[model samples]
Target chain A: MQRRIVLDLDLCCGCRSCEAACKAAFKGEARIRHGDIAGAAYLPLACKHCKQPLCLASCPVEAITKDEKTGLVIRSAMVCIGCKSCAFACPFGVIDAPLVRHISQKCSLCADREGGPRCVAACSSGALQWLSDDEIKRHEIGMRMVSKDLFFRRKA
Target chain B: MKNINPKAITIKKALCPFCSYGCEFGVIYDDFGIKGVEYAKDGSSGGRLCPRGSAAAMYLNHPRRLAVPMKDGKPVAWAKMKKDLTKVFGSPKSTAVTFDRNVTPEEYAAIIGFCEKVGIENIASTYFEPESHLEPFLDESFDVSNLQKTQLVVILGDPFNQTPMVSQAIIDWKLKDRKNGLIVIDSLHTHTAGFADQFLRVNVGTEPLLLFALAQKNFEGIDATKVTGIDRAIIKDVSRRIKDSKNSIVFACLSFGHTYDPALCAEGISELEGYGRMKIVPLVEFAGYEGNKGFGSIMEMAKKKKIKYLVNFGELFPFYYPQVAPDLKNLEMYATSTLKHSGYTMVPVPLTLEKEGTVYTSFGKKKLLGGIEPPSGARSIEEIIGPLSGGSGKGKQLSVPDHKLDIKERARRISEATLVKGKGLRLMGEKIAFNFLGFFEEASLKMNPADAMELNIASNDIVKVTSKQGVEHMTVRLTEDVSQGVVTVPAETPGARKLFEYDIDTDLRSVNFIPTEVKICREE
Candidate 1:
């Protein structure tokens, strides 16, 4: 029932349009981060929204909580003490306190928006997708087959 | 701090002033000021904007924005600044004005009228290459809408960085028509190349040669692999695919040095006329180029005679014309009206978002800047230049010069000529990142992974790049996108300008296409 954001690494061109769209949708904060891996692969990293939610557990003040309906990990600025505990606990490094604002910030998956995240809408290459758990599994299978084909072709 | 209520927000339609495309966007403003920007549904961009367009509001109220007029690095009153300007323009014959391409039509007309009245003949706009490239293509009656119907599309350079909307349109068309072929010919593996069905990484300044070879349908005796750094078979295959397509269009950006030979490429593309329909679309990437007609006429007159006093409006003098900076300093008087202080007789001016005027889009359509007020005290070009014109000068009618048609001979000569191999690395300028002002920043030397390894250089290491013009140290970035023997720096950086060879020819005045050879060494 919960939605997850999946990225197809092969489709991304490192344009960072999703990052820009996220910043525009939010108030000057981009939840999604784009970078290159040793000049070979383009990576667009965002909140994975793990079932355990390490960031939510690590918050001493209980400022980070998981949404009951969408299962998204949300951070509250009102209760946050700017201790950066959630940022240090999160394994993915998606949560961080912006220099201007002391509160820790991360992607909310555009929970309030009608459709989904703005990053998904802004992706021109069809690399980013918001889908249910079952849909993500099926999409991952298809992507794996394509990657395998490309890998074998390169090897040949 | 004033809390911005969502209910009190007002959406105003405005044009993106960054590039020449002039795509429309809706500015979300409150009583405090601009809050954010959104894509307009009925805009030229079709409800999509580049990263810069999405963050347009930040640039409008930048912390460093020029709010008041300054003289000798100190703020001055409007009356005193006007008196200083009058003193400079008192000698009309010796005074000249040059403006950035972002001027509105009415403001441009006012500047032209002022120049005519003052008999100032040394005025020129920042963007002059588009005048030569776009004029000839537009005269041929090339329609951009035809891109959707084309079966094959060829991009010369990175239009995605310059004109994202145009690039998106071509990509969307390709996605819809699965059989359509897309070819990207560039020195680096640009973002546009990611969507390309075939990407040919050619050597710098060798675009004309490859295009000529394709037109001749001959690759005899020459090692195509060595000259173009592309396989001969791939070239033959792409050429065959181009010839076989029904409708083919070549989208060429005028920002690159290789694109200076647009006439040659146009002629080469025309060779496919018998097989199929072919057209060339000259892409103008910068804003306000359409209003540069008045500025172009002044540049022509200045070359014919010497001028002493000069005024610059919204134009970055040394950034665009580095060679003329020394000459400008030697003048009797020099004044600049700009958003950022460049240390001339400074007169602060408002940006496009703060003014109401008409601007010509890259597509040659008229668009209005819809804001009601100029930023508290800042004045528009018309408000400043109008009073100085004395109201006696009528606007001058400008004409675009005809493009020379003797490109076939040059193409043949190029095809017969040998590829010149330079020692060490070939340095090129590329657009890297868009900052708050919609201009490129983070200038670094992007080297190929192989070249980086050979030089014992790692990513993010500082390196010294030396050209005949000068030497500058820049951080090194390793990437597989660039070819092995080439190093690329951000086109907007000072290091890139050092590679430029100054030529007063109107065609090459604004664009640098000469292949600059540089030596790169690790800085210890």
Candidate 2:
């Protein structure tokens, strides 16, 4: 019933346009971080906004919370300390550790904009997609990578 | 400028001047100023923008934007600067005019017309990116959708990082069928290479040899297997597949210091283009306006004291080419810039985004709407040339020098360069959309894990990279993306770009280099 950002690994080319869009919109604080699969694959890691969020539980000051209706995990800059507990507690490691204004970087999913998220809009490869639960279930998310055709993979 | 609500947000549609894709995006502006970039859904790529396009507004509203004329690193009155420039142009015979990037085709034509009207003879292009070597392929613009029908695609450099807009189509085309062959040839294990049907990991600076071999063009003393570290049988089979394939395209995204013989590399692409009956699609960033001669000839004239006053009408010139600055010490430079740079008499000029003109792109020419006004104290090229005496005439088109190449000689030199054991890692330049102008991301060095361990370097270790031109500190990223003896740094940042050493090839009459020898040490 909720909309979330999903990544199609098969389409990503690791350009980092999504991060730039986020940083540009948020005044230089990148909520999304990047990871390399041993230089074999590049992934842009954004907040999964899980059903049972751990960042919301790890926040000592209770700065992180999830909206029950939209399922958006939001972080308040005013209520937060610079302790980085939420960043450490994040299982996905999507929360960036380096503090720009002494606050853990968290993705708000471009809540201010009407078009869902800016990362999906500026995705050059169309890899990052913000979709509703129904659309997410209909599309084959991560099954189309090299597993179907390992002939292209020189070394797994 | 329009009758709209003061508080309402508006987006001005403009073509991205960063690269040739020319994807249309919007600059979000309200009553205050430029807010950010908006991805236009109906635009070329259907709202998909690269990092460079996304950061356009950030660059436009950067704190370091030059808003006034500067001389000797000090702000000077525009009147005084204009008078001084007019006096400098009094002796147009000794003056030379050059350009690089950020100039529209109309602006380039205006510059050339002004040069002809003012009696300035020495006009040349100073843009020497390896992508410029792919100029011949730009006669016809190919759409990205063509890749879907392509039976094979042989990519030269990392298109994923250099030009990310094409990556989606490439991936879809590769996955739509099982037989769609994708051959990536590079020294590094790039993201595109990971998706490659066969990645020919070549020796450093030996890509040209592999290309030539694939084209079936053999030269004396050139054993592609020995020189490029790629097996000959594999090369032969891949070459056969490409030739046998019905539709094939060779996508070139060359970077600075990535090739030793750029002209020869272009020739190799040409050979492949003809042999395989395929088209050559160069992912050009910006094909700069050319002059009657190459920048090498202009530099020669400057060194000989023939050119005293150098006036550039582009964003990058003497500033980006730090290595060529010392040679032109005898000459005076007055360059136009949108961002604050340290050298020369910088004339604050409006970026192409604010100008109403046409720009040459991969998909032919596109027009800049010029809805945005020029920054205060900044002027356009046409406005700047108003005071100077000249009746505008259409300037000459790209009269590029004919580079005659001897395949055997180039192969020999490249083979020798690859065979020579260097003391340090071979520093190759890379381009990433996010690292454009170093505004979005910091420069990081990509090296192989084996090479990193040998130098006692770890991932994220701050390492001091020393090249012949300069030294700079970069965070090291240990990955198999780079070859063992090769390391790549994005050339978008001046700190990393200046660390590259450039050489002017005599035969090509163009500047090119294979890779710089950079010694890296972990900063304790």
Candidate 3:
């Protein structure tokens, strides 16, 4: 089963514990970013690992690849040239070219480790969850059902 | 830096000293210092921690940590430093010691004993505020676990920002039982307010007035809409909810840096308890172990008598209230035992993870801290103060006096006092948890979206906030969370302290007041 990280914005407190933990785990590079949005809401942004990965298509040296097993968009530093094409092309803005490293870095979802991303583990609130595509679909359906029930109950 | 052997990993149990909630976490370490902190399923926290507790390991071995004692900006021998301290505080009666509340009970006892032996009556903790006169009504023994059983939970102030664990517990309760009522009463629309079943955005200092209105059950006379910025319908609904609930818990967030009459709030809770079983849990943000061990008494003595010399254990004074620095400087000599250089006769102390002793939690429970020895040349408070006092006696327990409030008289006083009104904006201050080298750097002013628009100010724009006392410049963060007339700044920021007006509450015998008025403008 393919795994993905899901962030429920409603439960996120914007404490940035995930960012701190990710940075610590990834040698000072935070794979996730958290910031406030309009209407006093906070959001955490990370790589979506899309089916049509823009970063993979935009890389000049074909440095970015998609993992078929995990469905994670993996960026390889070994094959990448010091070019900014992929960083610019990614819609999520999760990729960055560090001045010190000269290579682009992004969230790898902690695929090499046991368990999932450190960001998920570090989340104090149960806002960040690791789930398969089927689980995500079920979660969405469950949330929709709850909202519908509440709406009908209020109307009644 | 030394290479850590992953094979030699050891888990050491300790309490997080960042805040007073005193959540215990297991420190993962190898041959090197603290590698990481793992949540320990114990204590009031129930195996949960905020970002501060999780990131404590990074702070423990921070590059700028002081490892040795210094004199006049130069490293000094421990023996020489002791000699200098003896000279400065030759007559113990003329000397006073002020410290942070993170002190272990043993250290606090030793310090008190030492002060007593030296004929010194002046001892104070940074956390020492005059115990609220409203202490009698506050239920000190209210268990945190009882939140789960409560049908209604009323949270005053943002515990989600101040004490995350407590807020998490409330959230958990609400999530588990959809029928449970969670009411958040705050001046601003705090993050926790989003989760509330009912959010009452009360005016800044009118918290006491609203509470008073609730306590007296006289909703008729008071214009609830004008006074509290809450509609009368909502007020009646909340009152009915409180009246009907079998078990209700009110969690009051103390130490929010903004003052509201806690006594009046307590009185309201007491009134609600009359209708049914109600528990009032005061959530103080800082650990007051020093305050628990006779620090309040020492403060009382200091006010009555003149203290010639003041020696501070840790960087407590500046962190507590920078205004106290002038009074400390007035003393014949001032010294500090701190983790960083404070340009005084400095004695280095170990970080919480590097020392071993018991620390008091905000809940008044004692927990063990530190399993490893302090860095060489550094010492714990007990080690220094213990030897100085000749180890004669243990410290006295905290004596919280029970003062009965005349609710009628307090209501009269509340009505008589001028409410915050004018062209200026309301100033609110909050204590942000994230810090580096024990100093808060993320100081910014939060403005309401409407206010920001009226002033032609945008997010990240530097703005000038002018209170009666002084003016400060801070970056603007516009959000709809705050009301139209208020601006909130982090209380620990450099210039935020000067904005507050200090009034000695004769009844409470404490010098604390929330400054409510300020004029905001965009900086060109």
Tell me, by lDDT, which candidate is best: 2
TM for every model, in the order presented, reads 0.82, 0.97, 0.85
Instruction: Write the residue-wise lDDT of candidate 1 on A17-121 in tens digits.
Output: 677777766766778887655444565889998788999898999998887787888888799888888889989887767768888888888876556776776
Model 3 steric clash pairs: none
RMSD of 2: 2.1
lDDT of 3 by residue, A20-114 (tens): 66665566666787765545466678889999999899988888999887788888879988597888998878787777777887889987545
* Residue B378, candidate 3: alpha-carbon lDDT: 78
Error of 1 at A142 (Å): 7.5
lDDT of each: 0.64, 0.84, 0.64
Candidate 2, B389-492: lDDT as tens digits: 65445675757666667778778988888888987788988777789888877899998889988888899999999988988999998766677788999888
Using TM-score as the yardstick, the better of models 2 and 3 is 2
Among incorrect, acceptable, medium and high, the docking class of model 1 is acceptable
Q: With candidate 1 superimposed using the best TM-score fit, by how many Å does residue B151's alpha carbon deviate from the native?
A: 1.8
Residues B311-386 of candidate 3 have per-residue lDDT tens digits of 7765555544555444445454344443554456667777655666665455665546657555677777766665
